[model samples]
Target: MKLTLTPSTIHPPFGRYAHGVKATGSGILVASGQLGIGPDGTVPADAEAQARICMDSIVAILREGGLTLGDVVRLNAFVTHHDYFAPYMAVRDEYLADLRQKPASTLVVAAGLSRPEFLVEIEATAVF
Candidate 1:
């Protein structure tokens, strides 16, 4: 697995994830849906905030599986707010901006996430 730092016009690196990442292997990690729970098990109150936390959780899961965002070949985003497009893109670009190759992704809107506070959840599939 390889990790890389990317540049972006989006948000700053939150220190929770690499700007971009890459992985190579016979197989890659398939991340389960991540939640908004914080490292200390705290859940943020707002939808957008929780979405960021979910992204943070996915980052940790990818690292454990020996991969990074660049290794992600696909992404599925489940969001609660239709108006969150820009916020989501800002955060998304922050992680993907410098990737040499970009993953295919789709966004979906749901009535809600696992928790009422979970604004969004991103599940990923990686190919190495």
Candidate 2:
């Protein structure tokens, strides 16, 4: 089982995530940051679509590791704009809503990413 923690010392988390997580399992999967590019190497213009693709990539990696989205203990998202948070979170919730253990998460608004067309990049850590 994984443990999610939110200490009283810190302010409450702003979104659907914990402040920390303690994972249990012998296997630990660390997924690289995944961009919005799809199989055809095309990125969508909308941040919501890009976020969905990024989550799909992350789920694929987790499956390859013999895990599921529920096994994720942490997620780090990099976005090009602060306004993208709502769209990104919408997609995130759509994907992660069924998870029994909510993961620790962080979203950073970067000045720019590797490619201008890429609106979001997401990375994850899981144990199972």
Candidate 3:
């Protein structure tokens, strides 16, 4: 079972996410950091495109574990530049829009990633 929490004492989450999640299940799925590489191994230069690809990759991986984004308890997003934040957030919101149980998420601007063309990388944890 999974419990999503949002205490009245604190301000509601700024975006599509929960304050926290409590899970009591045997399956704990941890996904590796996923880059924005496409099927042809091409990385898009634009932040929005890269963000979308990253989210798509995460969804595909979650399905392999018999879970969806709704089951994700946490997400860690890494971007190469701070300017990419808005675009990344937009894409993330689109992907998680329908999920009733959102995950706690953190976004950080990193100096670089494994590849220069990689604009964003997203990692996730899901319990189901």
lDDT of 2 by residue, 36-125 (tens): 877666778999999988888777666645678898889999999999999999999889888777999999999998778888988888
Candidate with more favorable, higher lDDT: 1 or 2: 2
lDDT of each: 0.68, 0.77, 0.76
For candidate 3, give the lDDT of residue 36: 78
The residue-level lDDT of candidate 3 at 13 comes to 39
- lDDT digits (tens) for residues 1-128 of candidate 3: 75454434323434576544445475676666777777666778898998887787677666655678998899999999989999999999998899987899999999998778888988888887
Residue 32 of model 1, lDDT score: 60
Q: How do all models score by TM-score?
A: 0.73, 0.79, 0.78
Itemize residue pairs with steric clashes in candidate 3.
none
lDDT by residue (17-100, candidate 1, tens digit) is 653444445465666666666656577666567667657766666766566788888888887888876676677777788899
| TM-score of decoy 1 | 0.73
Off by over 4 Å in 3: 1-26
Better of 1 and 3 by TM-score: 3
Ordered from best to worst TM-score, the candidate numbers read 2, 3, 1
Best by lDDT: 2
